[model samples]
Target: MKLPRMVYNQPEVVQPVRTDVLIMSPWLAPIVWDGTYNLGILNAQYRQRKFRVGITIFAIKKYTVFVKKFIESAEKYFMVGQKVTYYIFTDRASDIPVMNLAEGRSIAVLKVPSYPRWQDVSMRRMEMIRDSSHTRFSHEVDYLVCVDVDMTFNDEVGVEILSNLFGTLHPGMFGLPRDSYTYERNPQSEAYIPADEGDFYYAGGFFGGNTEEVYKLTNFCHKAMMVDKEKNIEAVWHDESYLNRYFLYHKPTKILSPEYLWDDNFGIPAFLKRRRFLAVPKNHDEIRNRR
Candidate 1:
């Protein structure tokens, strides 16, 4: 007699999904891309940390001397190590320095199609990051930083801020207060701010979080843009405001400090910024060494 049909069960195999570490940057200003100088400090900070670090620059071909210098510096100083990778996301990746930075390890070059419009331009910034964040390489990153290329790492302010936030890794969001908004036009924008109110005005320059939160935030930002389109609001600089609104309304996690973020020249008191991210203090020798 034929034996009863045997039942076969497939073995349960677990496939670990991977993630990539990305530092998203708009690099709009040419002065901010000096890779070697920035990397010297970034490396010092990250060398002791336990995460892979990589940078993403949008529209690399338009890079000026400052931008090119930074890109080249990043290529030379931040070349791929076991844990780091540098990515250049542009419409044309053919001649861009994707390989020079990859060194021996795998370097990624992602070409995202372009668009027009100020808000759309900012959206492109997020798109480059989102694309990289969701790619196969994304799984390698425990966390990701959305940064502005113009900002330099005078010290490892990036890592210091991240360390503080990671230590408290609450289910919340963080950002720099907007440079005081004193609008000469648009009564609506002016009336929007009360003179005495000191609510945090999220600056879009830098922010980061677990890959999951970042994905969610970017997705929200994209959808919000669609809403703005429908409503015919044309202010392109409102991305940061949009984020500030979302975080305030949602009340995820609040990491508020200026140390983590300072505008090109807006010098908020060091103590205020230091509450969240500390500036590297000058040692006695260095202080005395200063002429």
Candidate 2:
């Protein structure tokens, strides 16, 4: 199929789009940033394909409060002209606010069980998504994006982000050396990574790929978590740690710059020219039931 006939900026072979930052990983995966690619061109290609995307998020217990704003913001800024299904996994599906979705967009809430501790809830998300991949997503969507429910879209997160496999750089860990990354160090845990070895600290909050690839990612992550549990050892950041381990070996086909996952605390560094998805500040003590 041909992309929509349209006129956009002409490409320049000698002119690199992003010179201030690393636009490509050592392994050659594209590191997506503000000036890296033309969104208009990418959108036309995906629009012609009429591909469907399933964005998965878990809002168990009190986290359900964030669902409304996230959904409303996504409707406005995410893949505006494409088909999307917001696959919301929430304990309080009834509490999710009702809003009129755009053309070719819809919401599907799967009532999930609530856990007492927030960590357990976070860890279980892998299994939940892993289970849904075959049961719901494979049949309905071409791509599956998994994100943390506590965040909201701050700008356009469109088809330019879709790929066979992709992961976002953790805003807090951006530009930090690999040794400084907070990887799970325990030799026994399946998520372990030696201090000297690591590529990038990927944010589990926003990661995905085509349904087939995402299914393998979730399956491996969920299984690793189970193995750790059997040994009575939990990875430092639970699912996030396991996710980092996954990427350490299976490099993402596309790596999203910190722009895709930012926190206000970072104060918008020069490289982070555009902020897309941002963290919604919350009192960890109150929301996560921390001591």
Q: In TM-score terms, which candidate is top? A: 2
lDDT of each: 0.44, 0.90
Model 1 regions more than 4 Å off: 1-50, 64-67, 71-82, 98-107, 163-198, 250-260, 267-291
TM-score versus the correct structure, for each prediction: 0.55, 0.97
What local lDDT does model 1 show for residue 215?
65
Predicted model with the maximum lDDT: 2
lDDT, candidate 2, equals 0.90
Model 1 agreement with the true structure over 1-291: per-residue lDDT tens digits: 343443444333573121121122222211111121244454465666577555555543333112344454444433235355545565556655433435433445666665544346555575556656776435866566565443334323333333211112111222323334421123233113344443344556666566666666666666665665576663436556455544444443434244444442335443332222222232434322222
Give candidate 2's TM-score: 0.97
Question: Compared with the true structure, what per-residue lDDT tens digits does model 2 show for residues 1-291?
Answer: 444568977898999988999999999999999988998888766666667999998877778888989998898888887899999998888888888998899999999898888889999999999999989899999999999888889899998898999999998998899989999999999999999899999998999999999999999999999999999999999999999999999999999998899989879787778899999999967877732
